[model samples]
Target chain A: MTRWGMVIDVGRCIGCQACTVACKVENLSPVDAWYAPVVEYEVGEYPDARMSYLPTLCNHCTDAPCVTACPSGALRRRDDGIVLADEDRCIGSRACMAACPYGALHLFEEASGEVLGDGSRGRPSLLEPYTAAGRIPGTVSKCTYCAHRIDFGTANGLMPGVDPLATPVCVVTCPAECRIFGDLDDPDSRVSRYTAERGPREVLRPDAQTGATTAYVGLS
Target chain B: MSAPVTAAPLPQNVFMDRWVLGPKTQRVWGLNHAIWFTLMGIGGGVFLVGRAFDVTTELGRVLGLPLVDVVSFVLIAIGGVVLIADLGRPLQAWRAFRNVKASWISWGAWADLVFLTFGGLLMLPDLEIGDSTPFSGLGWESEADGAGSVMLVLASIAAVVVMLYAGAVLARPRSIPYWHSVAVPFQFLASSLAMATATVLVLVVLDGDDVTSGQAVTLAVLSAALAVSMLLHLTTDKEAPGKKESIDRLVRGSSRTTFLFVSLLAGTALPALLALVAAAAGGARNALVVVALPLLVVGGFLLRLDTLKAGIYPPVTMPSVPARRTRG
Candidate 1:
């Protein structure tokens, strides 16, 4: 069983938002909802100041608080150790979203109506296509590791044509190639070896016992 | 030109006793609370009936009582009314469906309506028709009867949802941390149950019962447990900045002492002790249960009210800090 994880080398990242755009397109995320976001932070002052860009997505922790907090059993871990949401069972309670310390999950809202240039009401239509049965409005949506593409890729014994494993889209679309993704269970995997060779810092929320899978290397 | 100097006004701190809420929103929340209380009361009553009917072997006919069905109907009705009342425009509540993709409140409302209609339909056959009479020939039938077995199951499910919905409403990310815990639903359910038990004890006492030993003891134990849980939540967990400060103030101030001593000890503990003594003597436990019941109920109400008020703070998200080189 492959335990998927990612290694983000912040030292090499340029802060370009190509990954964010790619992720939005690949995941079909709604406007204002980014599965992968590049957070920029400024350091020092004046001429000597520097900026750091950290691309954040779901950590997919071993002890995911979201999974435990979901009362309806809508959020679950897949066989390959990926946290997935069963949209059909989701009641849109947003409890899982609250439990996530990393603010990864986004409660999606379908487009209700279009607004004219003068702010007048326009026609309303269903925005996103249903991916599962019994999926209703007002439910939480989040990064699914591009599970659909992953499944398709695994079945075809090839890399996903449409960015399967969604492997953190921001990482894949990075012009600097600072992001690496692979099975953490495999010692020789690119991500595993990279982290093993260069110590990486895992983001830890205070008092939260979640063991985050995503690691950041060469970050102060 | 000579600059004119302005005198600085002295700052007067205003103490807030009551917070004014929008009329419609306040009405919605008020109705929501009332409906939930009523449903919980009916559910508790049904459970009591089940205990009475089932535990007593001699009451064979009552064993098959429609207590559950009646409670289910009542719950559905209460839930329905709450959903309707929660809407901005009661008449145009159906517009809620327009944002089904993004609004949990709207979805939950629809679910409540569906469940209520379904549960009510299942309970129709067992509804009891009670004769109502006025001065002369005026009469009416009360549709409170239902098969206890079927109604119990439905009511139990609905009750769980009700509790979940209460918690879920406040469980948004980057929102109030006090309401963001996974234990919120459980806390709500436990408090609601405690309230129901207290209410029933009150009714029992008003009906001339002079003893309430068992009920009093239960209330005391539950109140203590709730207090402990609340304390743990406030102390151990990492809370939002505003919430933490407010809770700290509440606990350190006179509010804590008043709530613990007057509400918990005097209201709950004393009555529980009295009830225990009465029960031991095999005397009028009914009287004790009655006295303690009101106290317990009041204490529980205060507990919830204080917690809610104390935790009223806007949520804040800290700006991300840049990773920097530290002095080695």
Candidate 2:
């Protein structure tokens, strides 16, 4: 009954985009598609003006609108509360893209990987491990929270979010240590403790009533 | 002491179209979707009216097919094709058939398929195939009238569902301010009925069938409803954050030409006026039906296009507005 959740401490974020790069490289995501984008903006009037970064990603809602809207049942919620799209079953209707309030989901138009000059596809050795599981064109895709690494680590008797090898690339690579990912149901987990301390964290468009699991600290 | 307060500079990203949703962006369903909606709307509307009046007058057969059957079949068939073409993975389109719980598109796909297959079957009796053909006994005029009637009923129900389903799909995207209106679906229904009436008029003329007074009245009522729905859509209080901006875009911004001149003046008012005149002038003004019908139909399409193009996404970052009481 473990429910995976993300807690982003906006106060500690420096808008460095290291997590964005790490996520891109780890996922072999399209160059334009950033699974974790640090949105930098100025807030308040001139006298109180300050630059701030609010990083955003998939919320992985317990009541995901995308799952409900998906006609093919391609998008589904895992027992562990991770929302995923089954590529084989996807019809690419883009309904999930429309239903998502966070703008987290994206449609893969064309491959963004390296290609040789003579019309040949270039292979990246880092991405070779995920070749059988990479996204296909004409389908909607989003963050998976590094499910492969988590699964592999769990199989070898390691704890995700606690062990570096099992943690999401974004959380591990964030220089300012703004991101904390762990099971929300575990009272002893860091995320659970953080949630108890910062009881009124922010989730994007709470009015949408999607029951989003991703929460942001220092959002106000 | 409290810190001095001054006007904060507006966030640069607020004006940026990316990150913040606005004009000419955020079309999850685009031209193909609009086309499919239009075709299906017309087809369904035509079938409803055609059955209502029982207008079975046969125009001269082209390849042994009546004009009514040809038009309805083409509209629904092309709509089905366009719907399939809009999908990113057309090969996996069959997956839509696997689930029909909450998805309107899945229900629409099933309805479209049933309408096409059974509707084609219903047409078998009207066709002039030779007696030696194995399917000769299955014609509507033969022993198949009961079955044909049943198919027509089912197809008509399916067709009506298809018409409503198109609007529902567009309306359910809560993030888009322009699309999340009750008026939208009603506008679509009104336009569909008007377009179908206009199309039937054209077909009746082609079939050399005399235009009836009751048909004229029906067209008039539908046109009025269409006009009111358009007004309702434009004037409703859209309290969603960016909805007012979206409405402004349609009424006075980039989409004004089509919304005002085409959809309003040329499309709605002109047709309504002509239909009224024809109703007043009695049988003498049947020629006006020719001109008015095409205008009404084109106007119906323009209304849809305008509505589709006017859909603007609600801005991701909500803007700060100071509260003040003002006497209305």
Give the winner by DockQ: 2
- What is the lDDT for A220 in model 1? 55
lDDT tens readout by residue for model 1, A118-190: 5555554433243233334455667776666667767777543224353455555778987777777887877
**Interface residue Cα RMSD of candidate 1 after superposition:** 11.8
Docking quality band of candidate 2, CAPRI definitions: acceptable
Among these predictions, the greatest TM-score belongs to: 2
What C-alpha RMSD does candidate 2 show over the true interface residues after superposing them? 7.5
Compared with the true structure, the alpha-carbon lDDT of candidate 1 equals 0.53
lDDT (Cα, tens digit) per residue for candidate 2, span B33-108: 7788888888878777776666644544444555666677789889888888888788889998765887877888
The parts of candidate 1 lying over 4 Å away from their true place are: A40-52, A68-73, A110-122, A126-136, A148-168, A218-220, B1-73, B76-190, B206-208, B211-221, B228-328
After superposition, which runs of candidate 2 have C-alpha atoms over 4 Å from their true positions? A111-133, B1-24, B57-64, B130-134, B139-145, B319-328
RMSD of 2: 6.9
lDDT score, residue A54, model 1? 66
Model 1 chain B: ten consecutive residues of lowest lDDT: B19-28
TM-score of each: 0.58, 0.87
Q: Mind listing the fnat for each candidate?
A: 0.03, 0.38
